[model samples]
Target chain A: DTAVSQTPKYLVTQMGNDKSIKCEQNLGHDTMYWYKQDSKKFLKIMFSYNNKELIINETVPNRFSPKSPDKAHLNLHINSLELGDSAVYFCASSQAGGGSTQYFGPGTRLTVL
Target chain B: SQQGEEDPQALSIQEGENATMNCSYKTSINNLQWYRQNSGRGLVHLILIRSNEREKHSGRLRVTLDTSKKSSSLLITASRAADTASYFCATVPTSGGYQKVTFGTGTKLQVIP
Candidate 1:
């Protein structure tokens, strides 16, 4: 079974449009995260939620918001998507503890035109 | 900003050869973990080494940690073409309450058959 999964694997949208990506994990993990991989292949963490509680919020713009409906799901919504938002977004999950291993989902490739 | 940076942005090797990747971080970490990501896919957990542990081995994968130097290394012995992927080092900061895991720049490995 796929421990972690993401929907809308490929997204192409116009500038200023809004989009959302969904992620889910069946590992019964308590923490979920959203990461952005730029064209240079630099992966950066944007947000992390533990048991539906916001835990870490990086220096991301307010246009991006993450919502966790439950411990197993975390979704990212991007408002006013710009050309800079053209990158891969990855979702991951892990158990709530130090040194817990994280499982990532197939990334969503976003393209802004 | 990225807390970790990996050396040798890319490596190409023939199958049956050993592949080594090094990572250096700028902070005190509770643990360091290695992950592999195949092209167009999610990241896979490879191994993890705690701050107190010096080295760990799992099958053909060997991980070494040096907290004093804030560095780590991942070695894959007898690497196969199937092992070709992007390797990343993630560090769990020691101060964060929820332990935000930060990823390195990553090393892309291409194993030729």
Candidate 2:
């Protein structure tokens, strides 16, 4: 079974458009995270949710927002997308504790033209 | 500034050879973890070693940690072509919440068969 899954594997939209990526995990994890990987392969954490509560919010632009409706799902929405937003976004989940192993989704390749 | 930095950004090796990647972090950490990302895929957890531990072994993978130097290394023995992927080291800081981890610049390994 796929432990972590993401929808809309690819997304291409014009500048200023809005898009959303969905993530779900069946591992029964309590913490979910959203990460952005640039063309240089530098991965940065954007947001994290624990038990549907916002736990970590990095220095990301306000145009990007993360929402977790339940412990099993976390979604990312970007507004006024720009060319710089063209990158891969990953969703991850892990148990709520220190030194927990994280499972990641397939990732969404978003292209802002 | 990134919390973790990896050296030898890329490496190419023949199949059956061992590959090693090193990571250095700037701060105190509770534990260090290694992850692998295949092309066009998300990250996969490989192994983790706590600050108090010196080394760990799993399958053909071996990991070593040096808290005094604030560095870590990952060694994959007898690498196969399937092992060609990007390797990343993530550190969980000792100061703050545990769910947040700082990822290093990835090392892309090319294993030729």
Question: Which candidate gets the maximum DockQ versus the true structure?
Answer: 1
Clashes of each: 0, 0
Interface RMSD of each: 1.5, 1.6
Q: What is the TM-score of chain A in candidate 2?
A: 0.96
lDDT of 1: 0.92
iRMS, candidate 2, in Å: value is 1.6
Alpha-carbon runs more than 4 Å astray in model 1: none
> Tens digit of lDDT per residue, candidate 2, span B12-110?
999999999999999988889999999999999999898899999999999999998999999999999999999999998888744469899989999
What DockQ does model 1 achieve? 0.78
lDDT of 1 at B4: 86
TM-score of chain A of each: 0.97, 0.96
lDDT for position A74 in model 2? 98
- Superposed by TM-score, candidate 2 places the C-alpha of residue A1 at a distance from the truth, in angstroms, of 2.5
- Every model's Cα RMSD, please? 1.1, 1.1
C-alpha displacement of A21 in model 2, angstroms? 0.6
TM-score computed on alpha carbons, candidate 1: 0.97
Which predicted model would earn the best TM-score? 2
